[model samples]
Target: MNDSAIDYAAVFQALPGMVALLTPGLVIADVNEEFLRAAGRKREQVVGRLLFDVFPENPNDPAATGMRNLKASLQRVMATGERDAMALQRYDVEDPERPGHWQERYWSPCNAPVLDPGGEVVLLVHRVEEVTELIRARGGRSTGRAQGLEAELYSRARELQELNERLRRAHAREREVALALQEAMLPASRQVGNHRAAVRYRPAVGALNVCGDWYDLVDLVGGHRLGVSVGDVVGHGLAAAGVMGQLRSALSATSRVADGPAQALDVLGRYAHVVDGAESATAVTTFIDFDRHTITYSSAGHPPPVLVHPDGRVEFLDRATDPPLDARPDPIRRPEAGTAFTGGATLALYTDGLVERRREDIDTGLARLADSLRRHRAADPETLADAVLLELLPPGGATDDTALIIVRL
Candidate 1:
């Protein structure tokens, strides 16, 4: 589990098959014990030597093409940044005891490039499997058994490819199930009295990156009062989705009877402490009183709601900010803020994913959101929500899930 403690170099030495590490310049950089044993040389002798220098073609055997073929494969990998596999071929290793004599060896070799973070080829990994015994058993490659061996090798490669494909499909199915569960938990669209209300939810852009973000448009007991909330769980996938669903449901029910946003969140905070995997989650809740022209808001370590006015003004409802749910041991009352809104104004409550970029400042994201709201202040709630998503998220997609609620006041 701790990658920092892992000895990757040791792993390379213990890996099966004869593997040699070569720099892009074709210099021998490192080789496993298996490679050294196959070459009949020590690590010291072959590590700093050139590939051709370590095991040059047999001087006595004029037909020796091992070095030539291997050189071509390694060059291809370097040039194309792709893997090159060579078929069965004879490569002779010089005999240590016999001095001048060389031992004949047949091998199936593959050369693959290792790329750096920038995607340039940095090293080449040369892997080989010795099949001298199998080749000699039939006396030559022209025999039926040799042909059968080649067929078996092809069969093994195909089996590996199929297994990888099945695993890919299984992963895709799992992602679909996670996404379905999240979709089922989310509340569908509903009208807020006498106003244009829009809710949007975007899943993170990766397999199994769905869930953990949600929004709800609840119709409170009083038909004139509408409840809107957006929240984010601590993690992704099924467990976080379950926590998100429970928290969203609890708040939706509690807000109906509670006095204001603060009181409703007070109960939800306590409920969160008992819910598994619900700690440290963040959410923002607001009650839009269509009859009163007032908005009461509360946050659990969430970003403040954005209030955009028609006259190039944006107000952040941050007075009620508090630590995330279950952030402390004892239960405490959550803070709440209230503000009056004029007609044709908009209120936006969203999860952090709407603004936060990987390397940019959070304030910058908040400012961008404000600018977008102010720029599109005249647009309807639906158009404004879509505009914010397009303006803030990257072209590829957001790495984290986002939940957004836009209420036209």
Candidate 2:
């Protein structure tokens, strides 16, 4: 297009950045749409007015240097009849909604004088780039000392982020090792005495720390009897997992010598007092007698075991129980509860983490577990355990380690 047909006024308004023209006397002559938006003013309010009158220095801030610096830059342009660049400046604009309030802003400004044929300054072309967001994002520092402080803060943030990443990796490796150890200690699914026994163990979600929850199904001295145990230690990390390992080992050993669940738990409780960090551990021990068709179980401050009969009848072994292991130097002997079991009956022993939710009461969780067991009573031991876990602790639902054992007789 020819220069005459270009419509320079439209082009000036179409410019993306803020552009404005001022008289040699520093009076506002014309401004682009970007400038109007940035200044939050109408054309009538700013045009033909003195530039300083429209954007006066912030009177409340005695240290404000915006007006002074801007005036000096305009003076330099007028004197030299050449372009002048000003340093980054904080120029606060009056709030359109609130008359007395000033909104903070930052700008990088340049001024170029338009000379007449006599070499005298006629107009000043001003352009500005807004840097308010950038400055605020970089700590909103405007003082001389702000540069050093911002640099220090940025350096420290990077260092902290790197340190956190390293720590996260180290914790992940530790958790992997702990999880391997826990899995190694657990007994695989197999036939024990005339029953099919299966176990399910799920670690807490995002728990880089180890938890003290375990399940074991071991054979007794007589091949007809099977011993099943589920327990939870009080804390987390390597120590809790180690305690769980010790308790599992002790329970397996004691089950061989003790004739009943009550006797085995009593011996285990005594052993707990002697071991460091074994206090307040909760466990449920059960003896499955294949010949007698009975299950004898004892609880030490643990959730009750559930017995699902072949006829879809569910019973929780919620009897009287003693405190958790190592509660005292001489813990009281927990009483054993026995229930008759017919063929095709399933007994589920689980740690509290399987059913106990953080916000819900233990009784509610137990009821939900019982309901789930009743719904899937016909399922095989492994499938039944999986169903219960799916119902009670869905994906990312469990906040603690869960250990469950299902024995089908």
Q: How much does candidate 1 score in TM-score? A: 0.62
For model 1, residues 54-129, the per-residue Cα lDDT tens digits are: 7888898654556866776776666456688986667788887788788977788988989876445798899998
> Where's the lowest-lDDT run of ten residues in candidate 1?
134-143
TM-score of each prediction? 0.62, 0.65
lDDT scores in order: 0.81, 0.81
Runs off by more than 4 Å, candidate 2: 1-141
Q: Each model's RMSD to truth, in Å?
A: 14.6, 23.1
